[model samples]
Target: MADSPEDTIAAIATPPGFGGVGVVRISGPNTAALARAILGRLPAPRHATYAPFLGEQGETLDDGIALFFPGPRSYTGEDTLELQGHGGPVVLDLLLSRCLALGCRAARPGEFTERAFLNGRLDLAQAEAVADLIEAGSAQAARSARRALEGALSHEVNALLDALTGLRVSVEAALDFPDEDVDILREAQVQARLADLSGRIDRLIRGAAQGALLREGLRLVIAGRPNAGKSSLLNRLVRREAAIVTHIPGTTRDVLRETVSLDGLPLHLVDTAGLRESDDPVEQEGIRRAWAEIEAADAVLLVVDDALGEGEEEAAIRARLPGHLPVICVHNKIDLTGRVPGKQGGVLYLSAQDGQGVDSLREHLKAQAGFSGGEGLFLARRRHLDALTRTAGHVATARDALAVGAGPELVAEDLRLAQETLGEITGRFSSDDLLGRIFSTFCIGK
Candidate 1:
């Protein structure tokens, strides 16, 4: 494959596994040339043609559908070609080799998506949402990613930028006419607008926080005294005999983790060694690792035996957990204890064996993560949060500068800085290196 910047990029467009249909995608100025070389004729632009895909030696590799999308309106804004063929690894490899032989280079990870963002076919945030949508772990997460891909998040960012641009233009006009001696006090009006914008950005940041939570999900550690049915609860939650549940104390000597979704919120649930003094070295090491997990978790599930009561046992365990780590106290074996399975404050009573009260606990967990079980939620990344934080900080600085009557020129600098920070979220102010890092994480042929 040539290293020329204008060389066409090609890749298998489906998952690396057997399927009913597999697709090879190509995009660049050389798309039509490759299509002619491989398919024996140029594919009709924006149309599908059934044909026998061929190699350079005119060997029939697989008969498939060829589709073409001319530059400007297509994804990546470049001449594009797609070959849908039988989903076999051998067939895909041969077809890919043929494309390479015809002067089409293999695409890098996320190259297609990167090109799309670079060509203005999609904003940076929306481009990221495409990958998020593919990797979504829950229906809620997928819906959120779809909303973001549809421009819900980018629309808000663009609206904020437009307002900031207007304010910047006004300040620049005042700067151009220094002889007018524009009273800095009059800039209060602009400062007020910046403050309002900052408030809105705050709201968006909070919403994005919830979106990120739904995307990254919660890491929950189950820790409590020995014989609290922690293992049983884990098995029940995961709906399998994943752990060895026994009556003997200190039975679980290691940590067990499983990824589970509760009411559409993904969570990494960890069943750790019960937290208590132990004579065995293995149990001690497990306790140490359990604490480490508890510290790192986004939330903790303190499992307590309802039949045994939760007074001093629960207190000792709570004292060991890191402050600020959210905990949900579970009174397991509620059926045996005759306590109704329900949630009160931060405590949830449930019989792990019978599967009672699991629904209420799942609902509570989702509510804690800001999931309302609706389609309005949209996926967001940590990068967006950082940009919003920076933007909010700049907007605040500009407001302070105006309130003190420092100068319209100074306030204007803050406003411009805020705009740049906000622009980075959607690549309006992004550098090539940042763009490279973001797109390189995506699967090929995005």
Candidate 2:
């Protein structure tokens, strides 16, 4: 992701397919010269003008619009040019080759946006949202990513930074006058302010957590005995026949996985082989993989056949659950049992064949994952969440110090660490390794 100080980068911006038009994006100090060589003349800054892109041997590569954006006010904060031409891959390649022949290097993935970050046009969180919005699987995910792209998350972080800075000022002031008669640490106003800041930090942490869930979604694994309606329930939820359903036990001896969005949160639902001891080597290996999935899954869904009653099969299923996992026990085949489908003690009774009580099951899954949101939440990445968690831990340590009547020196040290941790979120305090990782995830034409 490193860029030379003087190298100009170019790339075909449109997706690789036939289309009405494609874009050749270029950025660097030499963009104007490349534009002039390809278009025969430089178009007005930030204006589109029709031009014929010429190639070697004076052949017309393509005719399209030429747009130029001078440096420091463009997407990458550098002189940039956009050449729009026919969507044919060959035509786009000819235009790109023409630009390269005139001294422009092909852009690496995420090089465009990385330059934007380095130029101070956007922060780390906002830059990531650009990628998230492009790859969002649902309308809700796209909307949330747009909010982060608009700086919603950065604004909140900045607000927290300001609060932390003010508190540091007060704490240091108190430390300066150690012998004063008035107890600065014990003052009612000071305690009230500190409590308010802590509460706000908690609220921000909760919001970021929800945003992270929306971005990455939750992983759910369905495990149960044979003939327990696991495949039936999966097919019913996806509203299609993605898995083969049979009355025979042990029909599904391999893992079947699907991605579905339920109520705005993406769900990676996996249907595993029935958890039973089998002499068949394939089935035994499948059962082992099922337990591995259960260990890493955010939630485990246990399916039970209600008509069959809780016999040895059901007992085996219950015994397989890992310690401290959120389990959604499902009692399938409720329609045949003549009982209404509902939840009782974290278990839901339903009929997967008839699609009965699936709505309630989806809601339960979301609630268990803490996804009580659709809009108004900013998209967040794992790195951003880690920073928030680290900063919050420091705040918690400072609160504990306050409770024990610790000296201002200890409290100030904790606050300083918290401030630096938060600063890393916005690149105010970050290592080059972190920057490289963040920008490497983006595409070349971003």
Candidate 3:
């Protein structure tokens, strides 16, 4: 971790591969000294200079561009150096070795961004957006992450925090002056303010839920009896033959998974073996795995033969599914049944073979995941949603306490807890373990 300003850290910033150029990044108090040792002269602040990188023995190791950024105005709010050179595994490794020899320790995963957070260059939500932007599954996701990185989410949180602080101060003032006739908790204006804050938090929570769905995506399990075109449906959704499709009843004896984007929403598609009893050990094992997948899926797409409609096997399979899991009855092979290709009453009639009604399925999946392709959505994580939920809970408690004419102290305490919960979203009140968990998920040299 980049926890100290004195401990210089370095790492190959560019991904490992032979490219036109690669970079070695170093940051800390000793960055200037390391640059002087490796480049023979310190580059001008915030300027890139073409220079020869040298080893300890004063031998030229590589020719590259050197950039220097002085502390307090850099990415990590510390002196940082970037050495750009030919992107070769051997060459980059040699350059990194030279930096280590010059007293720079290797940086941990996301240490660069972590340092930026600790140094106040970015809040927790913004820091997380860095990783989200890097690993965005779609353009919409990238846009959302960019909004979060630009302080869209943090701005909302700060505004809510300010409101909470103001209300808490008012309550405390009334508590301090018992001699005064000011009944802060019972005041209509105070109740209105609390109601306004709650409404704002509610709107933010809805947007955050959509953002979280975009980030984590939905896990959909496709299961049905043999010859129900389960594999065909999977192939149509993925736009390729991801799963082997055949006329055989039990052709597929394993669960196949493919991740695809449906209208900018990531869908983790799982195609399981046809759900049924089988004497063959392989088929039995596949059925077992299919049930396991159904148990954990966010949603299930039960593909059934339109000719047979819902039968005993379908009922049996449905009975095994987790009661809480949402199911979309997919009447596959509708082409053969002469049924129109569309959705009605929560059932989708489609032919997976000729792509009939697949678009409706895609739309249904997006709707089920609660994704709306729109602007102003900031990327958020589960923890952020949890914090917002807790904040809302506290605010609701305070509202109720005031409505019932509870003591000013109780209302103030609820407001205080609400403020602290909101602080966690922007990293103002995060635990060390939470920080470690959040940063460790990022790639090295972030």
Candidate scoring better on lDDT of 1 and 3: 3
**How well is each residue in 1-446 modelled by candidate 3, as lDDT tens digits?**
54565789999989888999999999999998899999889999988899999988999999989989998899999999999999998999999999998888999889999999999999999999999988887787789999999998999999999999999998887788865456743367789999999999999999899888878778898879988998778777777423222111123433476677776677877776655579999878877776776677899899999999999999988887799998899998888999999998878999999998999888888888888967877889888999999999999999999889888899999999999999999999999999998888887888
Best by lDDT: 3
lDDT of each: 0.82, 0.82, 0.86
lDDT winner between candidates 2 and 3: 3
**Cα RMSD, each candidate:** 5.8, 5.3, 5.2
Off by over 4 Å in 3: 1-5, 184-186, 240-255, 274-294
What is the per-residue lDDT of model 1 for residues 1-446, given as tens digits with 9 covering 90 to 100? Answer: 33554878999989898999999999999998888888889977878799999876788999999999998889988989999999988899889888888878999988888888878999999998998888877777788999999998999999999999998897777777764446454475676777789889998998888788777777788887788888877777666422222111123433466666665667677776645679999878776776676687888888888878778968977887788988888888888888888887668999888989977877777776666555577799889989999999998988887778676788789988999999998999999889878877788888
Point to the candidate with the largest TM-score: 3
TM-score of each: 0.86, 0.87, 0.91
What pairs collide in candidate 2? Answer: 109-444, 110-443
Q: In candidate 3, list every pair of residues with a backbone clash.
A: none
